[model samples]
Target: MTEIDVATKAPESNATEQPAEPIESSPAAGPAVGEHCVTDRPTPAGQVSTGEIIKINDVEVYVSKPADYPHAPARFLLLLTGGTGLKSINNQLQADNFASEGFLVAMPDLFNGDPAPNTTTFASQEESQSLIDAFKLRIVETAKSFQIDMWLARQTEEKVLPILHKVIDGCRDEFADAIKHGDGIYAVGYCIGGRYVLLLGSDAQPTTPGPERPADEEAGETKTGPLIKVGAVAHAASVTPKDFASLRVPVSLACVENDALFPDDVRVAGEDVMSQANLEHEVRVYPGVPHGFAVVGVYEDATIRGAQATAYEQMLSWINEH
Candidate 1:
């Protein structure tokens, strides 16, 4: 199988051309947690391995188009990676998987090149009494090393939103020109990345950051909105109920039972909030799994493997239906 290597001509931050929509420079409040998924990820079957890495200002973005890229029309998919950053094997695999699913995928280095350490490793089978215990140890190790509170301060919503906005603007400009009429934009966030994706979807109207643009640029066409039309998250971290308000866009949540970042109380509250938000939303629980189950979870366990596969399928189903 050959790889599809193509770089997106993502615009520079201070590009002269105005963005499709104004990106606001607001930081998300609260202690956002990062799920450090550190397991090895083999490329999926029939996946077009290797995506292009494009540099836009200070950020590095991994771009992956569908297997039959350039030949077939497809929707744009923005993938948000967890604490391990964009280059993590799992993240790369995730991008390729989405691309194989016929999406033009763009995964930016959320940590700007400096990703957190891969601290999530299980103890030896001999050391741990049971398989589940081994998996639990990895979860604890990851939590301790990440110091998520500190990481949040450094990469708050304020700092990260601007970068994402820039990427979204660039993607909209570059891909929309691919065909006469481009398809809609969608987003799927894993663990830490989920918080940012939710923030972008909540706003009824999100403006671009920096200076005010002219009226013609301010006007947003329904199809050309840089904001994600549909959003999905798997075992997300640091998402508050206030952020949930079901959001303005369609959303689907894949949650795990053993997640500290998103406890049972928070999950129930979020479900209630979304239930009343009057928006299209779905929240499904995966029992007996950890926070990173959807991304870099231990596939050895039958339960974990099954949940992981279903979570990924749910992500695809959400986008397809909505």
Candidate 2:
């Protein structure tokens, strides 16, 4: 399989009164309200049939369920959006592959509210720095705050984790019967989203630093949640050392050999953090893949494909074991 590389990054919420009139329910024949129903598209094999688009907590989220499967319903997967956003080629390929494997996939549009244009060319380091500055400014000005404890409680009690809960609940409501009979759920992410998977697993509390410590360290210590048996896969991104110190669940990190975003020394440092934490984790570097190799088929090398498949299979085994 081709090799790939990834870099780590830092990584939102809200509530409002609902007084609007309700819209009429879909006029189609299907399961009753709150029941999980099959919401497959009528497309030919190997093609994705668009599923449902729903408003969760005022955020528009798109959900896709597998077309068909004969196995018992005991497993589900949630695909989080990466740095390039939901419309990126890599995100789409991962979503389709997982859905085709009978896993429920949810791709939330994290950049939906922003007006940033998707561009590939950068004139210089100054331009890249400017873009980063703009992104940070926007996040500081627009992100929401939620009760950390309350959100964590919902993970086990409601079978839905925060951030993810809204999207999953929307899916369950739309396809209630299918989810009701389905197995537990898992989450996977790439790049920015990968960092989030670590954040969610660590259950870190959001707070400003007290005084002496660095700004990033001022964020409160990680909070533990009820063991929900979640298996998260993060590719090319590294978790903050302090955050990794608090993780209690099993997680895996896949590193790409040729990723310019994350250098070999940086990757080793990340692995060291995981080692110090003594957390059940694995970090494997693919020989010749570039960053985003797993999600993007940019390299057709056999080595890249094999590595991607191996990562997927390992994740499945971990999820199943849990």
Choose the strongest candidate by lDDT.
1
lDDT of 1 by residue, 1-322 (tens): 1221111111132244332222222254355564344343443455444788897545789988887777877778889988778777668778888888878888988887666655535545574378788788778876766564555568766667778878877776677743223356789998778877887786533344444644554342112332777888887876766666426777888887656777766666665555444456777777776677787434567777787888899889888776
Using Cα atoms with residue i matched to residue i, what is each candidate's TM-score against the true structure?
0.74, 0.58
Q: Residues 1-322, candidate 2: write the lDDT tens digits.
A: 4433433221101112232232222244111110000011112335443555556665566566676643544245666654455555445656766676667666776544431232222223453457779887556434311222232222221122344555665655655555555444466766545655665566543332457545544344424451223545535343333445445556766766645444555556555555444455656666765455555443346676677677666556655555
Question: In candidate 2, where is summed lDDT lowest over 10 consecutive residues?
Answer: 32-41
lDDT to native, each model? 0.68, 0.49
In terms of lDDT, model 2 sits at 0.49
Alpha carbon lDDT at 210, candidate 1: 44
Find the number of clashing residue pairs for candidate 2. 27
Can you list the residue pairs that collide in candidate 1? 22-207, 22-208, 23-207, 23-208, 23-209, 27-157, 27-158, 28-157
